[model samples]
Every structure is written in C-alpha cells, then in structure tokens.
Target: MTRTNASLIGFSAVALWSLLALFTVASAPVPPLQLSALTFAIGGVLGLVWLWVRGDLKALRAVPLKAYVFGTLGLFGYHFLYFTALRLAPPAEAGLICYMWPLLIVVFSGLLPGETLRKGHILGAMLAFLGAGLIVAGGLSGVSGAITGYAIAFVAALTWAGYSLGSRRMKAVPTAAVAVYCLATAILSGVAHLATEITVWPGSSLGWLAILGLGLGPVGLAFYTWDIGVKGGDIQLLGTASYAAPLLSTLVLVVAGLASASLSLALAAALITGGAVLAARAGRQA
Candidate 1:
C-alpha cells in the first residue's frame, strides 16, 4: 500500500480504539480479565475466519514463536492492564494515563537501530508528559482508589510502546504476527479469566452490543490495520497522530455520560496535540 494509505489505516485503527473505553465501561459487571478473554476470543475466532476466507491460513506457518510470545505480551498486557485500571480508577483519568503510549513510543523508537533521537523529539515528549502529568494530578485529587491501578496504566503505556517498537523488526511477518497476537491473547486471557474471576456473560443487549463492537472494531480489524500501518507507514507520524485518539475518546465519554470534561482535559489536549505536531514536523525535517 502507499504510505498515505497506510497512515490513513493507522488513523482508522486509532479512531476505532477510541471507542474502547466506552465499550469497556458499558460492559461493567464483567471482570476485566474475563472481559479481555471474551472479546479477544471472539476477535480471534473472527480473525481466523478471515484468514480462511482469504486463503491466508497458510501464512500462520511463517509466524515465529517469538512473535506469538512478544505479541501476546504486548496485546494482552496492554488491555489487561487497561481494563483493570479502568475498574480500579475513573475511566477518564485512567484513559489519559494509558494514552501515554504515544509519547512512550516516540521515546522508545529512538532506541531502535538506525533511529536518531533529536531535540524536538525530547522537547515534544517532555511537553506531552507535562500535560499528561497535569491530567493525572487533576484527576487524582480528592479521588481515593488503588494507586496500583494507576501504576498499571503506566506499565500499559510501556508495554504498548515496546510492542510497537518490536513490531518494526517483524515487518516480513505482519499478518502472522497479528494472528498469533490475537490467538495468544485469547488463550492467556482465558487462563487469567479462569484463575481470577468467575465467567459472567453480559446480561443486557447493550452489553452484548458493546462486546460485539469491541471484537469487530478495536480488537479485530483495528489490530490488523495497525499491524499494516506500523510495519509499512511512517511510524513517527502515526505515533504522533495517535495523541488524537484519547482526546476523541474522552469526548465520547463525556457525551455518553461516562465522564465529565474539565479544564485539565482541554489543556492536556492542546499540549499533547501541539507537541505531537511539533515532533512530527521535526521528524519530517530530519
């Protein structure tokens, strides 16, 4: 695919992912681990079905064990931490914390071979983190909850950044990597579900719809598109552009009554978006 097309795909994936918090919030009464298992299980099945329909099931043979291991750790680790964080804290606060992945990506990508860390990259990341810190501080005030959850969200950011960086090295096996990721996450989350929480299905239509939406949009197709984008497109631009997703997500939450907007959110949005733009421009110049 053309680079432009690939970037659009990445944007699409981010947009789909923006809805994740809303669906996760709607799927309440289901434990985080169990929710991860169910949605990923459904998504995995759908992915396999897609491969079969496309006559690409043979591609799975090319996937290395390492891909399965790292990809699963990345995909599962992220959502598991993310869902758990949401349950432990307010969704808005937790979401902002988790969105730290984009800045982390810019930071971690610099560590990769052939990638140079620049002043603008550092400057932009600092600005973004400053904004993110404001968000966390603002949201945490007067809120009493498990600090462990917030810490988990931070780890989720790292996991996602690592996953994205690792993915760059596996460009030759994109489809296989994503397939293994889905399957492994499904299996791991299934085990976590059995060990941690009793299985309880979503009892309402809206709940079922949320699961369906998640499986199809974020967990299924979005992963596929992202694998393509990250492997084939300009990773810098895509990573920077990703800052928009959380802002969009927060807006959706506010509209849906799941979260309230605050001055911190607006300020964070400006800082993050502006910083990301600066970074992307700097990358282009370099």
Candidate 2:
C-alpha cells in the first residue's frame, strides 16, 4: 500500500476502535471484564484468519521472539487496563484522559534514537493534556468511580506508548503478525475469566452482533491497522492523530443522549484537533 493509503487505513481503524466505549456503554447487562475477555478471545482467531487471507502468514513466521513477548506486554497491559478502567469510571472521563497517549509518546519518543522534542511537541502536548485534564475535571466529578477509572485508563495509555515503541523495532515481522501475536496475549485474560467464573452473556441476535463487531472492528482489524499507522509515521504523530477517534465518539454519545453537545465537548474537540494538526506539521518538518 502507498504510505498515504496506509495512514488512512490506520486512522480508520482508530476511528472504529473508538466506538468500543460507546458500545460498552450501550451494552447494559454485560460486565466490562467479561465482555473484554470474550471480545479478545474471539478477536484473536479473527486476526489469524485475516492475516492468512491477506497473504501475511509469512509475517507470523518472521517475527522475533522478543517482539512477540513485548507485543504481548503491550496488548494485554493496554486492553486489560482500559476495560478495568471502564468498570470504575464513566466512559467519557476515561476516554478523554486516555486520549493523552500523544502527550505520553512525546515523552516516550525522547528515549528513542533520532527522535527528540521540538517546539511543536512541547506546545501541542501541553495544549492536549491541559484540555484532557479539563475534560476529566468537568461535570462528572460526582461519580467516585470516575477517579479510579481515569487512573486505570491513563495507565493504559502509558502502556500502549510502550507497546508502540517496542513495536517500532520489529522490522522483520509484518504488522499483521505482530497484531495477531499481541492479540493472542488476551487468551491469558480469557482463561482467567473461565477458571474463576462463568462468563456467558444473555444476548439476543443484536447483542451478539455487537460483540462480533467489537471483535472485528476494534480488536482485530483496528489494532492491526494501528500498528501499520504507527509504523508508517512517527509514533508521536500517530498517537496525536488518534485523538480524533474520541471526537468521533463524542458525537456518537451526543446523538445517543449519553452526553450533551456542550461546551466541554467542543473544547475537547478544539484541543485534540489542534494538537493533531501541530503534530502532523512537526512530522513534515522533521
């Protein structure tokens, strides 16, 4: 694929992945942990099949052992933490805060050779984080779970930055292979659920379909594409561009009545939009 096409595909995956929170919020009876465990269980199989069809099977074979291990660290650490955060806080709060991955990557990329901070990085990251902080500090403060949920979600963002950095080294592997290996880590989490408690969900056709979408869109395809996007561009730009997903999510929630089309959401839209633009410009300059 051309680089521009690859970047678009990658961004689309992030947009699809953003819908996860909205679906979880709508899936009233489903426990977050149980849903997440099941989603990943199913998503991994789907990932393998997808790679096979795409002629990416060689990717699975070429990946390094260390890449596989580090991939697992990122995959499991991120999904598990993010879902656990949902159990504690409201989706909007966790989401907005977790969107700080760009800012975190600005810090993480400093550790990478040939990547360093610039004026745009400092200004854009500060604008993004301050905006995200305002979001977490908004009208939702009455919910005690919000604090814990946002904290867990923030950890998820940090871990994902780790994953992105680790992934940058796996040049021998296809992005597809790394995604499947990362996804397979969720089996441990799924097994923990099965060994401890029954995880069957009461569902009609539509409910099951939603779960399937979660597996396909967010877990399998979306993650695979994100790895592609991160590889295509600078890690910080990819992270910042990802903030756009939540802007899409905010619109969805407004339509669903879970959120108001209020000033806070608009402010978030501006900050995130501006940050992504700045990051992209910085990438071009570099």
Candidate 3:
C-alpha cells in the first residue's frame, strides 16, 4: 500500500482510540489487570482470526522472540498503566494526561536517525507539558490517588511514545506479529491479575459490551493499523493526527456523562492539540 493509505489506516486507530476512555469507564469495577486480561484476550483472538483469514498464520514463526518480547512489553505496559490510571483518577483527567503520547511521539521521533530536533518541537513540548502540569496541579488539590494516577498516566504516555518510535526500527516485522503481541500481553495480564486482583466480571451486559468494544476496536485493530502506519507511513504526520485522540476521547466522556466539562480541560486540550500542530509543522519544515 502507498504511504498515504498506510497513514490513513493508522489514523483509524486514533479514531478508535477516541472511545477508549468511554469503554474503559463503562467496563467499571473490573480491576485494571483483570480488565486488561479479558480485553486483550479478545483482541488476541480477533488478531488470530484476522491472520487465519489472510492465510498469514505461518508468519508468526519467522518473527524473532525478541520482537515478541518487545511487543508484549509495549502493549502490556501501556494498557496496564493506562487502565490503572483511569481507575485511580477521573477518566477525563487521566485520559488527557495519557494522550501526551502524541506529543511525546513527535518530540521523540526527533531522536531517530534521519530526524532533527527543531526549535518548534521543543517549544511545542514545553507548551504541551504546561498543559499536563495544569492537570497535575489540579490533581494535587483533589486527592493523593488522583495525583498518583496522573503520574502513572504520564509514564504511560512515555511508554507508548517509546514503543511507537521503536516500531519504526522493526519495519521488517509483519503486522501479523501484533497478534502474538496481543496474546502475550493477555497472558501476562492474566498472570498478574490472578496473582494480585480479585476476579470481578462485568456486572451487566453493557459492561461486557464495553469490554468487547475495547477488544475489537482500540486494543485490537488499532495496534495492527498503528504498526503499519509507523513502519510504512509518515510517523511525524501520524503523531500530529494523534492529537485528535485526546480531544475526541475527552468529548466522548463528556457526552456520555462519564466526565464533566470544565474550562481547565478545555484549555488543556487546546494547548496539547496546538502544541502537536506546531511540532508537526516544524517536522515538515525540517
């Protein structure tokens, strides 16, 4: 496929991710690790079905164990931290903080071999960080748990940014490999949940549907499309487009009555989105 097509495929992940906070919130009371296990297992099954349908099941054998290790760590680490953050803090605040991955991706991409760190990238990062700081500062006044969640969300952002940039280095890896990653993540999450978390199944059908939605959309196909995008498409452009995720995610929460609309969140969203735009412009100029 052309770079344009690949990038568009990647963009679809962002659209899917817009519903992440909503689904996560809707799948409530199920502990983070347990939720991760269930959703990722569903996601893994979806990937397996996809590979079987495409006659690419054999591709898994050619993949390096190290690649599996890397993918598992990336997928598991990001989602585990993200789910925990949302569980501990307000979904909107935690989600916005986690969305820093897009800005981080743009900034971190500068460290790649052919990319340069322009002034605008730095400026944009600073602006976006200020927005994050605003959230952190606000969290401090709320409760200790909120502050902890925000911190975890920040780290989750870093984890995903590093993972996305690293994916570019593994361009030779097939997209089908993400299936293995999902299954591995599910296994890891399952072990962790069994060890630490009490099993709390979704209490209602709506909760089950939310978990299914996450598995099918954000956690499932999003990873595959993202792999294709980062490896074959314009990474910087995708990073810029990713800013939409936070805005859309926050809006979804608000519209769903899971979160309240606040002036602070509105301002932070603007800052974060604007900074990403500035960073993208700088990348293009370079």
Query: Which of the numbered candidates is closest to the native, going by highest TM-score?
Result: 1
Candidate rank order under TM-score:
1, 2, 3
What do the candidate models score in CA lDDT, each in turn? 0.79, 0.70, 0.83
Tens digits of per-residue lDDT for model 2, 1-286: 6666666767877688668767765554666556766677677788777777988777677677777777777877787787677667876677666666767777677677677667786667777666665555567545554667878888998988777776665544577665556456666677656765566674676677777778777766777787787666566666667666666766777787877787887898789778878877876776
What clash pairs does model 2 have?
none
The best candidate by lDDT is 3
Model 2 backbone overlap count: 0
* lDDT-best of 1 and 3: 3
Once model 1 is optimally superposed onto the true structure by TM-score, how far is the C-alpha of residue 216 displaced, in angstroms? Answer: 0.9
Q: In candidate 3, which residue pairs clash?
A: none
Worst 10 residues of 2 by lDDT: 136-145
Residue 269 lDDT in candidate 3:
80
lDDT score of residue 169 within candidate 1: 76
